[model samples]
Target: MPDGQEVHYGDYVQDDRVHKAVYADQAVYESELDNIFHKKWIYIGHESQVPNPGDYWTTWVGKERMIMSRGSDGAVHVLYNRCPHRGSLICNNEHGNAGKAFRCPYHAWQFYMDGSVRQVPMKQGYDGVIDYKDPQFSMVRAERQGNYRGFIFASLSTEGEDLETYLGQGARAAFDDICNRSPQGEAEIVANCFRIIQHSNWKIFLENQLDAVHPSITHHSTGDAAAAMQKKYKDKTGDDAPMGYQFLADFTLPFEKWDSLQTVGFPNGHTQLTGYMGLRPRDPVTLAHEAALTDAYGAERMDEILSTNVHHVIVYPCLSVQPPLQQLRAVRPLGPNKTLTEIWHFRLKGAPDGIYERALAYYYHVNSPSTMVNADDLNNFRAIQEGLAMVGGGDWVSLHRNAGQDTVDNGVTHSVTGMSEMPMRNMFAAWKQFMTEGN
Candidate 1:
């Protein structure tokens, strides 16, 4: 769709490294919006966010505005927000009950919750000039729509794999990890979410999520402060600091420890980071929650479930999910150097209140707009955006650390070193494939 000089995929992304233009060039980003995002099953909204009939939430699928709404018949539909007539936004609000039908504000053209045309004023206005009965006159829907465990996604193109097949094992496992933890076998979205539009490319945030080396280096101050407070609390009260401190303090972990952890680069550009947080802390609240999980699933099954230790997973091109902590950040790229992230945390249904509190702390302290942890990351992302735009700066962004040490099997790459650039390389590989082969 974008036919510009720099849209050539080979020039920017390579086997082990990429050009800075991949992040800095407007042409490259536009190509991604068409080739990758529109062609693939981009995440739209969660079904849980619009549980009841007539509920709707507006979001973006690539550069196109979309509305994920539940119909009166209780079926979910992902429709383009544009009205068929004159291209006015069909659902203007971020989220609301469309009630019986969606009435476009521009012409008052109405459509059902499922996006079928219901009413248009003055049928005589376009008797022979337009075919009102044509399907094109209706509120247009996406080429494909999918719902996986309550998470919804849409594809603007008819080609490519079904969502389940597209996500593959690793990306699907990220959702499984979140769902399996709840005593009710579900995670419910909290009432609200935090949204921040960063001054950098969307890929930068997703890359940083699995970049083990940067956390300790970029967030050293916040980490050090939390670590110091933990010790001070121990000295003052003869008790360990609260679990919340560990949220910030983990960034102070030595490079040796970071290297000891494992990172799996899955097919389709997805990647996972293991061993950042020791999530299953033995405490009164956690013990109570464990009892609930154990009761829901037998002891052996509970152990089998809890034994799957994953800190975070990058759901390539769309989401960064921390299944263990019940949080997910969705990436929406606005331009080459601007990105919007929706920060949301979920409550494991049927778990204790204290367990939710633990999750709440992580959401507010680490992901919120006001937190120093996020501020630090924002600072660096902005700085990199500015630096890459410079004329004479270095051409390449290195993904060379542990470059040759990664092992590949069945299209997935496994990192020999925790801080390996395997994830970046893996993503670019997927990027290359998507852009070139259109798969």
Candidate 2:
């Protein structure tokens, strides 16, 4: 509607800003689904979610419904969830076992875990007219799929860079860091997730992920309250601060401190904000966990693993990963202004129970919908959506903070300051390329 096609996206070079219409435009949303979501390698679900054969998880790649399941052969497959007959969804539930075969509830047509046709009931109805062995009757598998570690992704378009080539160096760190935390070099889903439907464009949610400037402002009240409670507890007991309280207080980190941090922009739309939460305190629980890590990985390797400083890694258009906290939120855009985010946490395999509990604490306290931290961010997202809906309000959003200060090295852009809008610019750079280029 805003002549987004005529707007040579590259021509909108601003010292520190972009047109606000990019967030609210319906045409832009459609184009994004076609170009970015369809063309890029979109994350589906972790391979571990469907560990056993016949286990499947239904998810979205843009608006398409797909089932990510483990076949009887133990290989992961992505299949369109639609039944070949009548176009009914074969898998109704979000995730469950198909038990060696998936049967369509409509006509009772059965399919194997790999989407191969297994049986068709009422065989005599069309014996001569129809061919049972035809691939058309089978559930369609995704054209391309690739896995990095145990995280699985599928591309709708057949032509593009393979998963590893597309991820480049920047996006790989998200999965690598999460896995390396464990002494055994692995992590597993904590089972189930907190699914939140947000009243905002998906991009609005992603933009906030690496947005270093907003926490101190948007979450100030929540952080301030948590900090006060922490001080009071310390005053009353003369004991150490609670980890939960400190987690919330992290939102109130000084602006300069935030500015001192770094958010890296990668080749694709992937981006990461780097800063350690100081999670490892001298408390017995922490020290014990450290000792376990030291015992398993030795002192130097253990320290390196424990000292990995990653606040958030955003695999653009879909995932926001807080690897250090074993937390990830996957964004599924449903409409121009509707997004569903699946909030999931992971346990470092073989890690201490206390460490796992720490991850769970952060999962519920900071990332869950019930938490003040999340509520505050959601409110901002909704407000931005409403503001962008205004007809006469504005044309562009500003990504100007330290805009020109970012330096690109080896194709990765590094922010001069933590609050730099480099992350937004970096994502849009990828967005423009995906949208305008056919490949």
Writing each residue's lDDT as its tens digit, candidate 2 over 139-232 gives: 9988799999888999998999999998877788899889888877888997777899889989888888899889999999989999999999
Error (Å) of candidate 1 at residue 201 is: 1.0
Cα lDDT tens digits, model 1, 1-439, are 1236435666577667788888988877888899988898888877888888889988887789999989888899999999999998887788889888899898888898888888889878988898876898898889999988988999899988999999999899888988888889888998687999999999899999988999889999999999999999999999998777988999878999889988898878989988567777788887887899899998887887787878889988999999988889999898999998988889888989998898899998898878979899999999999998776857788888998889989877899988888888988888888878853
Which stretches in model 2 have alpha-carbon errors above 4 Å?
Answer: 1-15
List the candidates' TM-scores in order. 0.95, 0.95
Compared with the true structure, the alpha-carbon lDDT of candidate 2 equals 0.85
Model 2 per-residue lDDT at 83: 90
Candidate models: Cα lDDT each: 0.87, 0.85
Candidate 1 lands at a TM-score of 0.95
Evaluate model 1: give its lDDT. Answer: 0.87
